[model samples]
Target: MIPIHENLKGKVAVITGGSGVLCSQMAIELARQGANIAILNRDAKKGRDVIERIQTSGGTGISVKADVLDKSSMEKAREEILETFGQVDFLINGAGGNHPDAVTNTETYQDEATGKSFFHLDENGFSKVFATNFTGSFISSQVFGKDLLQAKAPSILNISSMSAYVPMTKVPAYSAAKSSINNFTMWMAVHFAETGLRVNAIAPGFFLTTQNRNLLVNDDGSYTVRSNKIINGTPMKRFGKPEDLLGTMLWLLDASYSGFVTGITVPVDGGFMAYSGV
Candidate 1:
């Protein structure tokens, strides 16, 4: 069980992609702190499973099948959440991942031996990733920000990545989209400052999640070449866990902890950003 924050008790939180590995863990942790969870996902079974876990753990929760990229889907999700939870105290935009097609097999650009390089990348694939990471958050905020603003201390937490700070080797689309999230966080914070709604992002380092599990870990359960490089660069010399993010998550949501803080993308990268790979 995770530590419970006093301020989170009885609060309402809506998490997009809550059925996934990391976000589901976030949902569970928030539930332990007494927040009413709304798990929004494209997969009905996955979302329901998360709700079951929350309920079994003695917390209030509901699963809503919603596609983050669709504005109408988000509108329906907002209605369902308001109907069930009464209010949205916090919003977590956690739906986004990199596609294999948007990534290059080779790190550096090559003249004759380009492997999934920029020229070979699919335009449709690039657009899809951008829509999910940046556009989805934009529309979801539009739908949920209304109700969040009604709460005494409204907060919108976005899941950014270390790639946003220092673009990773091969995932250009993911990097650009996450960079947009950081910029949008600042824009939203400033836009809603007078309304007492805080906007911030958590830029996490490499974590073994379903989205990139194959990329980081091999079929034999060994670390991939990229994973080894990441570990070596990190001061901690290890990958992060879902639990590692809870402290910052709670601090950003609880007004007492960060009443004056806003527009910051806090890196939870275990010194990955600090090291210059010397």
Candidate 2:
């Protein structure tokens, strides 16, 4: 079990995309701290599995099937959670991922001899990524921000990426979307300052998730060329694990620790953002 925060006990944390690798771990960690977890995701079984794990560990939680892009669906989820958990004290916007069609095959325009150039990238793919990462957070915030405004020391934690700080190769859509998240996080922090709502983000580096496993790892558990490049670029010379994000997460969620902090995007990137290639 992860470490618990005494302040987080009995708080309600609504994690969008909580069934996925990283966020599921976040949900569990928060649950271990005695928070009531409400998971919103498209996959019912996977979300229920997370809830089951929480229950088995003597934690309280529920899974609500909802799409972050649809405000109505998120509203329904909010109502369900409010009915079940009383109120939402924390909002973790974790629903976002990159699409293959939005990815380019070449790092630069000059290296696009294979016809998978940026010019050939699908517009729909770009829109999907932007909407999923940026707009989804906006709407979820709108839906949950109500309870958050009234709850004790409410906070919003956006799941950003290293791509937001510096665009990663071949994933322009994702980079742009996350960049917008950083901007929006600051905007919301100021917009809700009077309401005592703390808005911030966690910019995670490359962690091997199902979505990017094929892109980063080979069949034999060896790193792909791209993965090796990432490792070399990281000052730590290794990839991050889901647990790497927990300390920062717990810090940001506990008002006693981060009461005066807001509108910042903390990097959990294994020094990838600090390295300048010497």
lDDT leader: 2
TM-score of each: 0.97, 0.97
- Residue-level lDDT tens digits of model 2 in 1-278: 55568999999999999998999999999999999999999887899999999999999999999999998989999889989978889999999998988998888887528857898899999999999999999999999998999899999999999999999899999999999999999999999988899999999998999878988999999999999999999999999999999999999999999999999999999999999998
Global CA lDDT of candidate 2, please?
Answer: 0.93
Residues 1-278, model 1: lDDT tens digits = 55668889999999999988888988999999999999999997899998898899899899998999888988998889889878999999999997887988889888888468778889999889988899989988999988988998999999999988889988999999999999999999999999999999999998999989988999999999999999999999999999999989999999999999999999998999999998
Please list the C-alpha lDDT of all candidates, in the order they appear.
Answer: 0.91, 0.93
What candidate 2 gets wrong by more than 4 Å, as runs, is 1-3
In angstroms, the error of model 2 at 11 is 0.4
Give the per-residue Cα lDDT of candidate 1 at 108.
Answer: 87
Residue 193 Cα positional deviation in candidate 2, in Å, after optimal superposition: 1.0
- Candidate 1, residue 139: how far the Cα is off, in Å: 0.8
